[model samples]
Target: MVLLDGLADEGSETVVKPVRFRIGREGVAESVGVDVGWFTARGYGELEPDGLLRLSPVEALYLTKYGRVAVEDDSGHVMGFEELFSRLAEKTANLWRDYVIYMDLRNRRYVVKEGFSPHLRFRVFERGTYPESAAKYLIIPVYEGDDVVVEELLEYVRACRAMNKTAVVAVVDRRNEIVYYTVSLVNLINP
Candidate 1:
C-alpha cells in the first residue's frame, strides 16, 4: 500500500498527522494545500480545477476511518469518527454497505471510483493500472436478503459488455463481509 506522507512508520510506531479538511456548507469536504501529488497521483479524490482536493463522502469517510484526515464542522471543531460517520452517512443511500465494499477493495489495492450510475456502485480498475487504463469491472452492491431482480442483473451484465468490462456484484452480508460474483450472459447453441 502507498503510505501518505505522515502515515509512514517512524521508528517503532506509525506517526500520523491527519490532514485537516473542513466540511463545506454543502456538506462536501475540501482540503487546501494538501499534498496534491500524494492524493491525486493515488486517485484518492479529484483535484479540482481551482486546486482544491474535493473528497467524496466515501473518500472522506475512508480517510477519516484510517486517521489519514481530520474532518471539521462549520464551527471548526474536529469531529470524532462517529460524528463524521453520522454526518457523512446521511449523504449517501447506504453508507455502511458502500464503505465496507470500498474499504475491502482498497485493501486489495484496486483503484476504485464511484460508478456512473446509482445501481452501478463503483468502477474498479485493474491493480496498478489506474488513470492509464479503463476500468475492468463495474461493481454493483447487493446487500444480503435484498431482493435480486433477474432483469436488473441482466441489464448490468449487458451494460458491462457494452463497455468491454465485467459486471461484478459485491454482496455485503449481515456480518459486513463481502463476496463477489461475476455476472455474465452466455449463449449455448444447439448442437
Candidate 2:
C-alpha cells in the first residue's frame, strides 16, 4: 500500500526528476547520470564491476512506468513506454509474464533482481536486505499451460537449496494473476 501510494502520487506536488538512461545497441540499459548509486541503493539496478548502473529490461520498464527514469535509444531519441517495452521484450523471453511478477513483487516492497541461472526468473530479497545480503528466495515463473518437468524443477530447487534459499514457483494464469508455491526436494527413501 505504501509502495503503491509512493508510485501513484498523482496529487503530490513534488516533481521527481527522472534519471536518464540510454539503451545501447546490445539491448542493455545504462544510466547516464550521478544517480547510479541512488538507483542501486534503492534496489532498482545493479552496479556493475565497471561502475555502471546496469538495468534489466524489467527494471528499466518499471522505473520508466513509475516516472523515476527516462529511457532513450542509442541515438538520443526518447522512447515512450510502449516503444521501450516492445524493443526490450523482443530480447527477453516471457517478457510480459516477468514484468507482471516483477511489478507485483516491487509493489509489495520486495527487492528483486534477475536470477543468477537460466532456470530462475528472479532472485527476491526481503524488505531492507538488498545491496547488503543475498536473496532469500529464488523465483521461477510458470505459465498456466506450461509442462511441469519434475526433474528440471527438482534441479532448480536443489540449486536454491544449495544456496540456502527458498525455491518459489510463481504460477501466472491466463488472466495474469499470480500464485506462489514454495517447492522443496523430498527424499522418499531414507538414505
Candidate 3:
C-alpha cells in the first residue's frame, strides 16, 4: 500500500529502501503499481493484469536489488536474494542465467522488457524511450555451457527479423558474466 503510493510519485530508478510487499495465497501480491508503472512504461509488464498487477519473482528480485521493494514470504519473513532465487529457479532451470542477462542489460541502461514468445528474454530499447516504438533488439540469453545448435541460432534471428528488431544473444558464462553478440541473416546497410 505505502510502497505503491511511493512508486506512484517517484521514478523507477529512485531507491525505495525496504519497500514492503507480501506474497498472497495465489502467489501474486497486493503490491501493484509500485514498480509496474515504470517497468511497464519501459516495457517490462503488461499494461494490466486481471486485477492487481502480478510481478514475477525475477521482477521482484530486480526491484529489490535496486532498493525498490522488499517482499515478505508466506511465512511472514523477508525474502533474501538467495531464497527468492532458489524458490523461483524451481520453475525455471535457467532463471539465474536469465537474471544475469537481465542485470547486465539493466546496468547498461537498456529498457529491458521480459520476452513472452519466441523464446527470448528481453526486448530492449534505448534508455528514456517508451515501448510504443519498436525495440532496438530482442535478446535471447544462453548459458555459455549450453551447446547451441546452428538451427536454434537461426530461429532466433528469424524471429527478431519478423518483429523488425535486431537479434542479440547474451552469452552468459559460468561466473555469471555476460558477452553480447548480434546475429543477422540478411544484408543490411547502416544509415
Q: Which residue window of length 10 is worst by lDDT in model 1? A: 4-13
lDDT accuracy of residue 54 in candidate 1: 85
Superposition-based RMSD of candidate 1 using all C-alpha atoms, in angstroms? 2.6
> lDDT for every model?
0.83, 0.83, 0.68
Write the residue-wise lDDT of candidate 1 on 49-144 in tens digits: 888888877888888887878989889899877898799777677988888999999888888887878778899999889899999999999999
Clashes of each: 0, 0, 0
Score candidate 1 by TM-score against the native.
0.90
For all predictions, the C-alpha RMSD in Å is 2.6, 3.8, 4.7
Error of 2 at 54 (Å): 0.8
Best by TM-score: 1
Candidate 1 deviant stretches above 4 angstroms: 1-13
Candidate 2: tens digits of C-alpha lDDT, residues 1-191: 12232232333456666778899646778877554655666677778777778889899889889887789897898888899999998888788899999999998989899898657889999888887899999998998889999889988998999999999999999999999999988779987
Overall local distance difference test of candidate 3: 0.68
State in Å the error of residue 11, model 3.
9.9
